[model samples]
Target: MLFSEAQEAFKKHLIYREMSGETVKGYMKDLRCFNRYMTDVYNGAIYVEDITTDDIEEYMHYLLDERELAPRSRNRYLFSLRSFLNYAVKKQWVEHNVASEVDPVKVMEEKKVALTEEEIDELLATIKHKIVKFSVAFLYYTGMRVNEAHNITFEDIDNERNRLLVNGKGKKQRYIPIAKSLKPHLENYLTNIRGPIDSPYLLATKKTGRLSAGYINYELHRATKELGWDKNVTCHALRRSFATNLLRKRVDVFKISKLLGHSSIKTTTVYLQLNENELQTDIDKL
Candidate 1:
């Protein structure tokens, strides 16, 4: 079977499995270079089933050595190829998935940085725009992704439950309880900052449109420009601050994982990085 034929079948299967369109597109895009390599290096003569472990290793070497791609990026390519070939094996187009046996590039996790409570206050104080301030607050406090915060609607807020509906990655929806401290800020935005806007999005721009992720990121960096933070105050930094603070207060890691819309508790526990107060508290106890 041809690689192109297998590609379309794998894509259809992904769509059938309810994968997001963006995710499907990404998988297909990553495979394009591999397909090109097969055509160019082997003169388009290599059959999909006949492709061997040696062929895969050379491809991995080609990605890291010839292309000089980053490990994280190479891992993505490996993931795409592995998933595709696995699908082909199920269909009997390939006898075995050679790509599945290939190890992907290992991605090293960096030390997570979180904002100080004082630094958070300073950052929020610096944001003079009501909309930007409210947006940043929603991200920092609710532990929502920047896109989730940006695309939130008034209807998504549950006054009775005191939770906000978060549209998370891969089109999953979850509700996170709004903090008591954040409740007033949200109400303030609805009553005063929003100003009877017709736009359904909670964070509307000046023209009464949904705030784009880029615009929110731009405002965040702008606020942090003169603040001299040790780390750049990106959207993820606000999210990190939310998770770390909760962990610092002895909140259940599993609960925090759910609130953050993480599929794995491991992902949420990365924020358990020890702060000065935590280190000192443990040392004193010792």
Candidate 2:
């Protein structure tokens, strides 16, 4: 089949697999770019079976040298191609995914910024919306992604156990211990703020039911701006702060990784941001 035909089929397959609309759109955009390259360079509609690893490798160079795409951006294009070819393989359009044989551009790991505990407190106080305030607090204390915190039901709160049953990425469930500092606020929100809402989610507006991840980040950003702070604080920043604060308290990285529900400890380390003073303090202790 032609690459363009296979591209359309792959798009439908992505949607069928329940990928988000934005994600599917991005994949299609990348695939369309690849198809355009094939059409221009190969001089016609190219069959998927005729494409080889060398062709994909050459395309990577085109993205880098000709298109001047950054390694990270170029890698995204390669990733999109890899996903498409993988789908094509599953559909028996190709014997193998040649795109997989091509190496992605190396990207430097950019350290994520985390808010200090004091900054978190000030930001939470700045948020006027009760739901948004509680959402920020929940993310900071629980180290949950915005979606995971939004998905938390009343049943997920095991108050008797002093921990929460969190449904994390990929439908995986884990328990996170509630900090003593957060318990009072959680209780107040549950008793006074969220009591009237009939929604199952712990974080919900009475009219809208469950709050969206975008809304959560928007409120957090607004709160940060209100504080006259120039930091790029978001819901994910709150989560990073949680990990960083725990590390400051000398918690084991492995334990923190489990609490954050990260698939790898290495992923959890990316969330931790300790300043030079903290590093020196640790070194001094030794």
Candidate 3:
């Protein structure tokens, strides 16, 4: 079958399985890039059967060498292609998934720098946009991903429960405790800045409805620069700060994993790096 033919079917499968809109868009974008590469490299026409393992390797090398994509980014492209090829194999369109045989790009592990509480306060106080200020603080306090926060509605928030029902990654729902510090911000945005909470989404833009992740990141980075913070402060950075601070405050790793909505505790372990004081305390305990 033609790659394009299989691509459409795979897209439908992804949508049917209820992948997030952003995820579906990313897959479509990667597949389109693959199709364009095949046309350029293979003289204009290619099929699923025409693709070989070597071709997959060459394309990865092109991304790493020519495009200078970071190891993680290159691995994501490989993953997208592998998923498509695997779908084709299940449908018997190809004898095997060549992309699957390829190894992922090796990424060196580096400890991510989580923002300090003082930095968080500085960033929030500097944000000129009232809606963005609340949106970012919401992420920092809740440790919710950008997409998960986008899915929140008024009904999802339980003021009495003092928690939020967030539709997290992998279609899982988790409740994050709302601090008393955050209550005023939430109350103000829902009752005033957004005006009537008519759209149901916790955060709304001037265009109406839930704010997009793109807008959140753009405004966050812009606001951080205005505060003279040269570091790349992003939505995820705020989420990381929440988790790291909790760990520093002696929160259980298991509880932190649950709060972060990680599919695995192993993912959460990456953020468990100890500072000098923390290590000294552990040493003293021993």
> Which predicted model would earn the best lDDT?
2
Q: Estimate each model's TM-score.
A: 0.81, 0.76, 0.88
Give the per-residue lDDT digits (tens) of candidate 1, residues 36-87.
8888888864568877888888988998889999998888888888888888
TM-score of model number 1: 0.81
RMSD (CA, Å), candidate 2 to true, equals 4.5
Each prediction's Cα RMSD?
Answer: 3.2, 4.5, 2.4
Off by over 4 Å in 1: 36-47, 50-68, 128-130, 169-172, 195-198, 206-208
lDDT of 3 by residue, 125-231 (tens): 88888888999989989989888888888799888888999887658788889988788888887677877545768788757667877887898889877888667
The CA lDDT at 100 in model 3 is 83
Rate residue 217 of model 2 by lDDT: 78
Give the whole-model CA lDDT for all candidates, comma-separated.
0.83, 0.87, 0.85
Where's the lowest-lDDT run of ten residues in candidate 3? 270-279
Q: Kindly list the per-residue Cα lDDT of model 2 for residues 1-286, writing each as its tens digit.
A: 9888888888888778777566788998998898899889978989999989998898999998999998999999999988888888889989899988888888997667798888888888899989788888888888998778878898998878988999776567899888998888898898888867778888888788888889877887788788888778888888899999999888999999999998899899888899998889889988
Residue-level lDDT for 279 in candidate 1? 89
Best first by lDDT, ranked? 2, 3, 1
lDDT of 1: 0.83
